[model samples]
Every structure is written in C-alpha cells, then in structure tokens.
Target chain A: MSRKPIHRLPAWALRTNGAVVLLFLYAPIILLVIFSFSASRIPGQWGGFTAEWYATLFDDSRLQRTIAVSVRVALVSTLLATVLGTMSALALERFKFRGRRVFDALLYLPIIIPDVTMAVMMLMFFSQSFSLLESLFGIGLSKGFATIVVSHVAFNIAFVSVVVRARIAGMDATLEQAASDLYASRWQAFRFVTLPLIAPGVLGGALLAVTLSLDDVVVTQFVAGPGSTTLPVYVFSLIRKGVTPTINAVSVIMLVASLILVAGSVGLQRANASRGRQQLRTSGGNS
Target chain B: MAEAKRERTERRRGFLLALPSFAYMVLFFAIPLIIVLVYSFATRTSTGSTSLSDWNFDAYRKLGEPIVRNVVVRSVILALVTTVICLVVAYPFAWFCAHQRQTVRNVLLVAVMIPFWTNFLVRNYAWRILLSEGGPISSFTEAIGLGETDILFTKLAVVIGLVYAYLPFMILPLYASIDRLDRRLVEAGRDLYGSGPQTFRRVVLPLTMPGIIAGSILVFVPSMGAYVTPELLGGGKETLLGSYIVTQFLTARNWPVGASLSFVLMAVMLVSTVVYFRSGGKNL
Candidate 1:
C-alpha cells in the first residue's frame, strides 16, 4: 500500500509504458477471440459474425477424441503426481536424510530442463526399452497413451512437490508436535493436523499438474505414437497445416479451460492466506 | 537409547516417504537422460537405426560442422536478443507493479499470470494469426497509410513471439525483487546527493541482481531451446537449435546427432540453472 516513487521517470511516461506492455501482452489474444467468430474463412478477413466455428468443432470427432485423450492423461497423471509429489515435499521439508542435496537437485531437474531435451530423451528411452524387452522376452511396447501419462507424471511431480514443499515449509511444525504430545498417534497427527493445513497446496499442485498435462505439446509430440495425439499437439498439427476457424475455436476452448483452472488456484490461495491470518489472530488471543 | 531409536525411526520414515519420488525420477527421468548420453556415442547405421556397438565420437564431432555452427549461432543470438528485450521491457513495468497499491498489484500480477498459465501453443498460434499476411497488424499499418507489412514467418516475428511468451517469466521475478526493495535505502542515497539514475545504479541494481540473473536465465534457456515459436512464427525457413534437433530425429533420422545435441543443450541449461540458484534466485 506504500506508494513510494523511487525512480525518476515521469509518471506519465511510466503509466504509458505500462499500458503499452499490457496491450502487447493481450492484443493477440483479443484478436484471436474476436476473429474466431468471424464468418470469413480467411483469418483476418471479417465477414458477418457467426458461431459456425463452434458448430464445426462439435462435429470434428478427431478433435473430440484428442480432447478426451488429453483430459484422461491429465487426470490420471495429476492423481499420481499429487500423491508422489506431496510425499516428497513432506520428506524434503521435514526430514534430514543422507543425499538430501542430490535428491533435491534431481527433483528440480524435470522443471529446469528444456522441453525439447526431455522429449528426445523420452523418445530414446521408450524406444530402447521396447527393443530390450522384445529381444529378451519377445514382448514389445510402444509410445502412446501410457507413455504420455508417464511422461506427464514425471514432470508434474516436480511442480507439485515444489508447491507443496513451500506450503509445508511455511507451516508451523509445532502443531503436529503438540498433537503428538497430547498422546495422539503419528497418523492422527498427520491426518487431523497436517492434512488440513496443506490441502490448499495439494489442490493448487493438482491444478498445476492438470494444466501442464493439458497444455503440453513438445514432449507429447515426440512420445505420442499412433492414435495418441493430445489436444495441444493436435492443434499444433492443425496450425502447421494452416490456420483455420476450427483451430481458433479449439484454441479459445483450451485458453478458457486453463483460465478457469488458474482462477480457481488464485482464489484458493487467497482464501487460505486470509484464513491463516485469522487463525494466527485467534491463537494470539489464546496465548 | 530410546531417544536414539526414535530418531532412527523418524529418519527411516522420511526415507520411506521420499523413496517413491526418488525411484520414479530415476526410472523415468534419469534413466532416459542416461540413455540419451549413451546413444549420443553410438553408431548411426545407413538405414538410420542406431547400433549399440561401434561407438565413436562422430556425433560430438558433428558439432563443428558449418551448418550446425550457423544454427547454434543464430539460436544464441536470438535468445540473447529475447533476453535483453524482455529485461528492458519488464524492468520498468515490474517496478511500476511493485510500486502499486496492494489491490492494484494483485490485479497486475494476475494479468501477468493469465497469459503465463494459458496454453503455450495457443498463444503462439494467436500471434501467427496477428502477424499473418492479412492480419491485424498488417491491416492497421495499411489503414494508417504505412503500407502493408509482411512480418509473419520472419525472424522479427519469431523474436516477437519469443518475447511475448517469455516476458512474464522475466516480469514475475523482477516484481518480487523490486517489491522487496527497501525504499529507505533509496531515500538515503538521494539525501546523500545521489541522482535518480545514480541511486538506481548504485543501490537498487545491486539489490535486484539476483532477480535479473534469474529472469535472464529463465528467458534465455527456453529461447535457446525454443522449437514451437520458431517453427510457428519463423515458418521453418530458418533452423534454430530446437527445430534442428527435432529435424535430426524425425527427418534426418540421425539419432546420434539428435541425442548429442540434446545432451549439450541440457548441459547448458543445467549450468545456467546452477548459476541461477547460486545467484540467490529465491523468487522462482
């Protein structure tokens, strides 16, 4: 709330710069939304507005299938990632064990590595594994839905663990200790005390995991086998072919879905923060 | 003895809790990287299938090739430009955001996040629409009597897309650092006869150096490894490191080359990441 003017730039210049940058960030998105409804087949040309693109999208079974695949992959991967990541976060935050630094670095690797490298690495991994299996046991496997889900979980775990670890780190450890001192079992301490405190973080991590899984393209593109294309990868393919009203509609849908997810995350965090403050105030009064 | 036993039990519990994640990373993440490393040294067959035997440094030697060098140089330049542009554009905006009232700051931060969290491919596709031959920018220029501009599929368009995509990465960290700035220090510097720019250079700049380094690494690493933006906006005429690496795998069918390129890119990213954390990049 403190408005201290530290920089000497003219107020008008600073305000104008802010406006221009916001416009730069948003103009394309606005244009994309408006033009998706345009009746013209050409992207820029605007005929009378129509909802034909949305109608066409409904009829595109290929798009529908890809969307379904994406959702399934995201849901399954997010579930696995939430459990694994939350456990890892608790371990990292609360425990002192051997090789902690190396484990920490390993956890961050998926997030810091470039998408292209991860993609190619996954490609090599799945292919080589398949050949090894085939040569050894005459059983073969290929990249598809399972590979996509596995890769999604691999990266999503890192993100989930980071978010959860931050929450766990900020939480007061004495609450659980107090529970135990009162003769509560460890499971009771965790379940009754720790779980509620970290629920927002868990939900936030799950939302992030779902969003990343849905939005992935580079990794999915490489690992996706026959009939395994997700929505974003499918959209990328459509763009490569040429821009169309269908692509616009699909893009808008994807954007809206993620917008809702992000909004939910922000809302949850804000609510938890206020509740935390209220709890602190009440606890202070008791003290 | 009882205390020691309890401590050992806690340690065992912690290890048990962490074991699943560690195992998953090893199997899915680390092993794949090791496979890439091994393949980087394997022999490429005439039919493009990799042979496990007859290892050589042929793939690593390909790094000195003229074509590969040109792509690497181009990618490095483009990434540097993107990083510099993002910094120049984001610094003042982050300062402005950080200086705002609480409500206003939250709104601005949310505005930044909306785009950041949106689908990456869709956002780039939006730019493709905006910069297409008959798109909005072209239409606006002609309407303003500047004549039509063919900006799509050019390196300039690619730069625009890169900056657009990664600008928020730069902004968020800068905002966090600037918000943490002690305004009293600035006032002190000014009272000591420091000019606005002088105070900024001597005090504010050093304080936010971590954010600057972190933001630059965040933008530069992805820009260097960018495949989608260049392929989408650059129209595939120019081959950057990302597209080049992909081409080696899919089109050229040279797995060794692709693996080696990937290994080098990951190494560069890993080093930058180490530098980023070492520089006290706490915001990210």
Candidate 2:
C-alpha cells in the first residue's frame, strides 16, 4: 500500500512561509543596524563609512543623563517588583483562599490594559489628590522617579506572578515533603527546597520586569516629571526634531545590552531546566 | 506541639509575604483607577483642579461627537487588521516551529523574542527610515524602475508597524498551543479516511483556537491603543485613540476630554476582552 505524501506538503509549506515570516520580523531591525554606520547625514545617503554617530552619542550629555535615569528606574523597579512579585506568586500558588480568581484577575489587569490608560489614570490620581496623599503620607505623590517605580511595579507584578506560579505548579512537592520529614523547620524547608526551585522563575520574571521598565515610554511619559526623562522618551523627542545618526547609535547600544540580558536569562533557564530534569532522573533511579 | 507552632508560623509568614504586593496594588493600581472613575464625572476647575459638585454624563455624552466616534471606529478597525495579519503570518510560522526538532524550535523561539528586547521607539524609527522616500526600500524600488514615492506617512505603514511590533505576542501563544497538540489526533483522522485539509479543519483548528484567541487578544488590544508606531510611521497625519488622548493631556491640556477618551477606550477594550474570554473560556 502506498500512502499519499500529505505530510511532505505541510513540511514544505511551513519552511517557505516560515522564512518569509522571519524576514518580515527582522528586516526593520537589520535596516536600523545598517543605517547606524552608513556615515551619511541623510538616512538613505551612502557617503562612505564613519564612526561619527557613535562618537556624537558619547558626547551628548543629555542623552547620557537620560540613559542614567532609565537605568536607575529599571534597577529600582526590578528590585521592588521581583520581591513583591515572588511573594505574591508564593501566596497565590501555595494557598487557596476566597476571591482567589478575582485577585488573580486583578493582578493581571495591568498587563492586559494599554500602558497609556494606566499612565493617564495614574496622572489623574497623583495630580488631583496631591493634598490627600500629602496629608496621609507627609510626601506629595506627584511625577518623578517614585511614581515611575510604582507604575513599573504595578505592571510587573502580573508577569512575575504568572511566571513564578508556573514554576511552582511544575515543581515537585516531594522535595519540600522530604525536607520537612527530615526535621527541617517550615521556613527551612521553603528556604532550601521551594526557594531554590522557584529562583529561576523569579529571576526570569525580574529580567522581564527590568527590560519593560527600561523600554517603557507611555506610562513613564505620564508619570515621569521634569527631571525624570528616560532614554526612550529622549529618543522620541530626538526623532520629532529630526532623524540623527546619534539616535541610531543609541538604538544599537540598547539592542546590544538587551540581547546580552536575554541571552543570559535564556541560558540560565535552560541550565536550570536541565539540572531539574537530571535531579528527577537520579531520584527516579535511586528509588 | 512543634507541628502546631510550625503551622502557625507558616500562616503568619504567608500573610507577611503577601502584604507588600497587596499594599502596593491597593495604593497604586486600585486607587488610580478609582480616581479615573471619579474624574469621569467631576468638573475641571479653572485652576485645573477637579471639582466633584456636578456629577453628570457630560464626558460620556461628549463621546458621541464625530471626532471621538471616528477615532474609536478607526482604532478598532486598525486593531482588527493588525490582529488578522498577525494571526495569518504567525500561525504558519508557529506550526513550523512546533514541528521542528527541539534545537531548531529553541533557536527560532529565541530569534522571535530577540526583537522584543530592543527599544520599541528605536524599532519604530527604523521603520521610518526603511519606508521613507530616500530609504533603502524606496531606493530599491527606484533602482528596479519603480518611481520614487514616500510610503512612510501612509496608513499602510502604520498597519505594518503595528503588525511587526505585536507579531511576537501572536506567535508565542500559537506555539504554546500547537506544541501541546497531540500528533496522534492527526494520524487518527487520516485513519478514518479524512483528508489532510479536512483533518486540520476538523481536528487541529479546533484544538488550536484557544491559542489563536489568546494571541489575538494579546495583539489586538495593545495595537488598538498603540501610539508610538502610528505616530512615528503615520507622521502624525492620522491619529489613533492613544495618540489622541496623549495629545489631549500633554499638548491640548484638556483634562476632561482626555480622561473621558481614556475611559471610553478602556470600556471598549474591557467589553471586547469580556466577550472574547466568555466565548473562548473553555479552550483558554
């Protein structure tokens, strides 16, 4: 009996379509990198090659300041979001309680809602109720780094919780059980067993949170004050003025930095997954 | 005795762990949203402070104006177009990835994710260069004897940019669903005298519909409010709801109108999301 080769058709079609899709996804990025070093003042003009744009970026104090601010915000927000996110993940995944679905949905609301909406809402809240916050907390909650951090954390919580929850759900309960049976305290069991198991997920979430905090423009624009300009916002202002090679240089640098972070995180996650699998295999063999 | 103490301590620790996130969300997320709801009714004072004395549907009523209506309709259409394009492109690619070897799948997934790591503003700007009159695309076209023309500021460019930016969102969920599918189902369909297309339509499509719905929501909702892509690519000649609201708050200084526009956009998104999840709840 001869079978008609239907599978071959799908395989061929997938390959052809996949290549076209990849091209569409990457062409803009490739063009950006190419134009960065084109040495021409005009975007499409090829006037030989030059390193002038990179040099100009280095000398631009304003851009540097904006980069610094963006880094600071991303750092602080990542730290705060990671800690709170991990805790929230633990609570939601480990415990069952009333209104759990509502809480879960509430946690995810920020991720689904457009950033601009969140930004405007935060602006309305801070600007309109300055006096109320001042009276309650002795500090005005207007635009600034503080506001950006709060907004970043608010959005990041959902991501972090989801990632950590997945890790928790996939984790083996026997490890914790074994630790407890070995006379370890509850805190000790968590610290040694559960924490280590969930650390990769938390780290992955933190990396994502950091990337988002750094690249965010909409929410940052609304909440950031006069002195709180970020790199993306600065780039936006620069583009409105005109397209300069200096902006391209900044883009290249951001691309390089983010690629490094993503590669590092993916590597770590892979290593953790392999190690977890290995541990499971060894345990299975021993049993 | 020890077990009882351990249980008590664990309970205390759980609450302690949860407190920080709860407090932060309450203060920032919950309160800001409430403020938006309140301001949707109250009047804006001459001094720029909002007064709550007059609670009416004035802002909601204003949404009936042609400009607001047009922006809302345009936003929905643009989002729908982007979602359809993303799904069409991403589905086949995701299916390819899912069928590939493990190493190949991992590499392709990373390739898809790497673009997202770049600055969104920078990526949009890059598109501007590529689509501008003197850009590579135009130059290539001219070299091939096609006349030079600017495509950068067109609505087509905006749609392209939106699709590019959100394609990853579409692909990832599709990959997840497709990868989870059982190959035996296809084989079983073939055994029952079903053709390949029939098997795919009857079996595979239904199984993967959840991923399609999730990916559509991920792409469409965000694209509806996309400001950066349209602003950069459309050259500000056109306005979507996001850009309109941004201008209102930042440039126009019309607090009531901006707040109202934002709420309306939110309402549209919420209703769509509710309808989508309700219909797609089983698969999701």
Candidate 3:
C-alpha cells in the first residue's frame, strides 16, 4: 500500500526467481504434452502432429491391464482406507483415553516412515506369512493384486486419518451435543449429524488416498505379483526398457489428470474457507 | 451409578470406533516393522538366503563392508546435495508465494503442487526424455554454446531429477512457516534500520528454522532412500541406497543385508526427525 521501499527491489528478484523455478517445474511436462502429439517415433524430434500415441495407449493390452489393476487397487484401498481412517479420526478426535497420545503417534508412523522401508517390511512379512499359510493351511496369497491393495490400504489409512482428523479437530462440538439434546441417541447423532458435517473431510481424505495409492511405486514393486503390475510400476518397467513417445503420451495424460485434481482441490478449499467466513460473519451479526 | 455407566459407554464407544484401524495397523504396519527388525539380525548364508537360525549382528556388521559403506556414503551425499538445492531454490519461491495476496497465493500453491501430484515416474520419465540426446534441454545447452551433454544416465542427472522431484516437499513447509510469520516482527526488524539481508539473517532465518529443518528432513530422508528417480535417471550405473537395498533383496537374495540397510536408513530419518521435533518442529 505504501510506496515501494528499498527492500522491495529484491522482492522483484524473488518473484523472478520464483517464476523461473515454476517454469522449470512445468517446462518438462509441457514438453511432454507437446511431444505426445508428435508423429515421430523418437521423443526428441518433432514430426507432424498426430494422435497416434493416444491410439497406441488404448491398444496396448499390457498398459491397459496395468491401468485396470491400478484402478482396482486404488478403488478398493481408498474405500477401505476412508472407512478405517474416518473411524480412527473420530475416535482420536472425539474421545480421550490414557494412551490417546501414544495411539495417535502410532497411527502417524506410516506417514512419517519412508515408503521404501514400509514397502520392504510389508514385502518380507507377506512373503513369510504366505509361506507359513502355504505350509499350514494350504492357501497361498501371491504378491500381486491382493498384496498391493492391502499394502496400499495399510499406508493410505494413515494419510486419510491425518486429513480427516484435522478437519474434525476444527469442527464445532456443540452441534453433536445439540443433536443429543434433541433426544437423538449417540449413535444416531453421529450417523445423522456428525457424518454429514464431516462428509467433505471424508471425501477429501478419500481423494488423497486415491492419489497416494495411484502414485505408489516402491511398495507396489516389492509386493507386485505376476500379472498384477500397477501403472506406475509398468511405467518404471517401460522407462527401464527404454523410453519412447508412448511414455510421453502417458505422461501427458497423467499431467492433465493431476492438474485437474489440483485445480479441484484448490477450488474446494476456497469454497470451504468462504463458507466458514460466512458462518463467522452470520454468528457475529447475530451476537 | 449413572456416572459410571456413562463413562463405560463412552469408553466402549471409543474402543469400537477405533478397533478396525488399530487392528489393521498392528497387523500390517507394526508387525511387518518388527519382522523387518528381526530379519535384520538373521544370518545370510553363502547362498544369499537368510537363515532365521543363528541370528546375530552379522548383517549390521556387514554394513561396514566397502560396497555397502560406499553406497551409504553416496546416498547420503546425494541426499544432502539434493536437500541443499531444494532448500535454496524453494526458499525464494516459498517466500514469494507467502507474500502474495490470498487468491494469488492459492493459485501459486496449487501450481507448485500440480507437478508433485503428477505421477512421480511420469515426471522423472519426462526429465529423462528432456535430458536425452536431441531433447529440449540438450538443444538449449548446445545452442548456448555449452556443447552437447550426455547426462541422461549419470549422477548429475540423478541429482537434477531429485531436486525437481522433491522441491515441492521443501517449498510447502517453508510456505507454511512463512505464512504464519507475524508481519510486525519483520517490521520491527526493519525499523531497527538493519538491511534486508541483515534482518533476514537475524530475524527471519531463526523464525523459519523449523520449516527449514522439516523441509530438509522431508526431502533428505526420501532422497536418501529414493527409488523411482535414481532408478529412472541413474540408469543403474551408480548404486544408490534405494537400488542397492532392492538389489540385496530381489536380485542378490540377501534379505539380511537389505533389512540392515533399511533399518539404518530409517534410523537416520528417525534421528533427524526427532532432532527436528526437539528443536520446535512440533506441527508435524
């Protein structure tokens, strides 16, 4: 609001530096998007534009199968994670117990620990557990689809709980109390009052879980069985085999999806913030 | 009697709500961590398979081997370089973002995150393509009279990929701390007639230390144990910790050594994290 201070000069430098960094962040993806349409087989050279790679993406049964597996894993794990995480958040946020702090830290362990450690441990445990099962019960659980889903849920639940718990911690307690005062039982209040109020948080948590599940690679790699490769894993294998324009096409699609999700999330947050402000304004006006 | 009944009900309700997640975490996360810890002590036979019998500190001892030692050193160095680069590049941007008006800040933050949420492999793969021969970066370098570069599979490529991949991790935390900074403290510092650099050194840096450490840990720990980036970019020519541990398990079939490496990596992360928390990075 005041005239630009002597300090404001470096602010321009800061903004320029920020812009450069952002451009660096985005330039590769933009190149990928542009090159996705190149008819050239090589990712480097640009031929005439074509949608050939997108067509290839649809026809590649291997890529399609991996996509299917990733979707299935993401869907199942997100669902399970949302339920489990919401429950944990509810218990942790809404109650007090002797070991509450300890339990809360334990719940966050998965989020703090690196992905590789978690993946390797899960891989070791599942392999041993499967071998033990094969010996004792004559049932074998392979390290592909089932393991990936379970492994995903194991970490996904923790992330979901963090998101949902933050939301719950900010929520007003008196609404549930009012519901109980209106002759609603505790279970009924939670089901009808608490659930609806926290639906946004639950949805946000589920969205986060979906992204985390899809973005996973290290854990999925260790536990993936034959024919159970997820998209990221498949992409890694593709990169190893040698990158092609097809990878560019895949990268373009993923970039678009991520951009959409980021936009949606930012929009949702703005909406939520505005609604909270309006509620505050109304309450203050009443007072 | 009524009060006792009410306490009992609340306790039961909390237990019922928490049961499924608690049990699942115990079965999958805690149990596997214990299994890995136990496996770390097991003996690796000449055949590369670990024998649970005759468990000792052999694997941990093997961590001193030149090969393992080199990988640990290399991974830590790479992680440190990556963390430093991320911090330097991210600090200005995070400050810029935090200083912007609310709407602009929101938009900028989302733009920064879009790259992160994009598939990690996809982003790294894009870099490989860009760094490969005739790629955009290569062409730019050539046109600038810097000459052609064959960096795709090299250690330099791995660092570039790492800095790009984890920059957001650094920026987000820094932004959180900067956004929470009280403008009056900054104003008071400026009123003391200290130069911008001096004020930042004396006031801002200390205030943002928590974010600095948190971001460094977030970037450093994962970069030390990185897989997708180095694997995609390093071309397996250099053995970083992530690939080395994977090799120990999947290829070399040496589970004990792999477990030891994993435990060591986690131990490093845990120590730094604890240090950060103790130093007032408590919002985690």
Reference-based TM-score of each model: 0.97, 0.94, 0.96
The best candidate by TM-score is 1
* Ten contiguous residues with the weakest lDDT in model 2 chain A: A2-11
Comparing 1 and 2 on TM-score, the stronger one: 1
Judging by lDDT, tell me the better candidate of 2 and 3: 3
Q: Is candidate 1 or candidate 3 better by DockQ?
A: 1
Give the true-contact fraction for every prediction, in order.
0.79, 0.59, 0.70
**Model 2 regions lying over 4 Å from their true place:** A1-11, A97-99, A133-142, B1-12, B44-49, B280-284
Per-residue alpha-carbon lDDT of candidate 1 for residues A122-206, written as tens digits (9 for 90 to 100):
9989998998999999997888999999999999999999999989988999999999999999899999999999999999999
Candidate 2 lDDT over residue span A194-249, tens digit each: 99889999989989888888778889888889998888888887787788777778
The global Cα lDDT (0 to 1) of model 3 is 0.87
Off by over 4 Å in 1: A1-6
Off by over 4 Å in 3: A1-9
| Candidate 2 lDDT | 0.83
Count of clashes, each model:
0, 0, 2
Task: Grade the docking of candidate 3.
Answer: medium
- Of the two candidates 2 and 3, the one with more favorable DockQ, higher being better, is 3
How much is B231 displaced in model 3, in angstroms? 0.8
Model 1, A108: alpha-carbon shift in Å?
0.7
Q: Quick one: ranking by TM-score, best first?
A: 1, 3, 2
